[model samples]
Target: MDTEDTTGDLITRTGFHFHIRHAEPEDEAIVADFFKHVTPEDVRFRFLSGMKSVSHERLVEMTSSSDARRVNFLAFSPNETLLAAAMLAVGKDPQRGEVALTIRDDYKHQGISWEMLAHICRYAERHNFKSIESIESRENHAAIELERDMAFRAYTDKDDPTIVVLRRDFRP
Candidate 1:
């Protein structure tokens, strides 16, 4: 599949292939629908809140934003089913960006998270970010381990004892 289109890019993993692309404002409906399949626990993990449902306003902001420093990526299965979503928010500090990743409820353990995080790392690097960080709840062992495996160092958040900051400083 061609990787040059604005619609999406087809990426092949070890045993499967999927399409990933930047989200557009028109994707608000689908992006909102994508949240329906995300587990409640994951929703909390993703938003760091007890949100049972993603608000329409939040979805709108995510899809409608034209900010150059903020990007949201969506991953879809070969059959065009949305599988995962990721966000990279670059703050004033050009040296770092904060990232978040979420997968559909039934798609866990499929390596999508790893691919998404790796892709985000490369994306951050290309944009001149020297590091990327993810704030994770301490209870989220799987995500913490995944980040550690990717060479991200875990530091106790200076302000939050209930969470840790996983940061990966890219090599210059």
Candidate 2:
């Protein structure tokens, strides 16, 4: 049986609602669409490098890999449409971790990102991780604010201009 981490319910904030669930094989298509909308430009902004697309095979590997270092999750709307996604990777230290979150373009500024991050943070905390980090584009102030509100320390290097790292301590 698939064991659930800490984030096993619907998270509601403001006027929006989303649930975090383990992504299954049946979700491949919507997940692919999520990545498609994620786009080369979006990837470049998030990664600070151009990426055309993430392959389906790579996603499958990320979800089921025995490494257990990473796990995939989907944020679905009340109507069951995907609104956002997050992949949390547990590092070798167990106390170190990283996360990536994406919101559907059509649903921007609808509180989807906030709910997703909250769930990710809660999940990280329950796992005994010391911190969870986010790498984002310097221009994405909205994301920066979200991270800040979640109590993360954010850094953007002038030399590296494009990527900002946001770190939130998970250990209490």
Candidate 3:
């Protein structure tokens, strides 16, 4: 079940081998289907809005390979089922980036998010980024706890009482 592609690498987690690669323009449908499987609350947590469905243009932006500042990774099971998606949006400062991730509801509590976050962090550090950040809903306790366990500092977003900004600083 091992494979490789131009987008990125393949890795196994908990006996399930999956590909962790950048999303291609042709992957719009796949991403759309992945979003369809996400819960409403999960969608709110991921988008920070009550988005019941992702728009086509937003999906295009997510799948676009031309955006140098943004990198979106889609994880697929060995059988080619989309299991999760993670994104990194680097800022103009180069040393800081914002990250977001979502896993299918059925895949939660299986160490997938942890592995994806670790992989994304390594990717950021390798690209010379100094820190990675995520804005999470205060009700997203699972994600907040996961980020905290990964050493990301969490702070209340003053402008939005319902949001918490979590940051992980990488050592040079």
Residue range 8-92, candidate 1, lDDT tens digits: 4544355556778878789988889999999898999999999889998888766754766778888989887888888888788
lDDT of 3 by residue, 15-71 (tens): 555668888899999999998889999989999997778999989977887777888
What is candidate 1's TM-score against the reference?
A: 0.91
Candidate 2 stretches greater than 4 Å from native:
1-3, 65-67, 156-161
Please name the candidate that would achieve the greatest lDDT relative to the true structure.
3
| lDDT value, residue 43 of candidate 2 | 63
Provide TM-scores for the models: 0.91, 0.83, 0.91
lDDT winner between candidates 1 and 3: 3
RMSD of 2: 2.8
lDDT of model number 3:
0.84
Candidate 1: where are CA atoms >4 Å away? 1-14
Mind giving the per-residue lDDT tens digits that candidate 2 earns over 61-141? 535524467777788877888777777886667787888877777888777777777877777777777998888888778
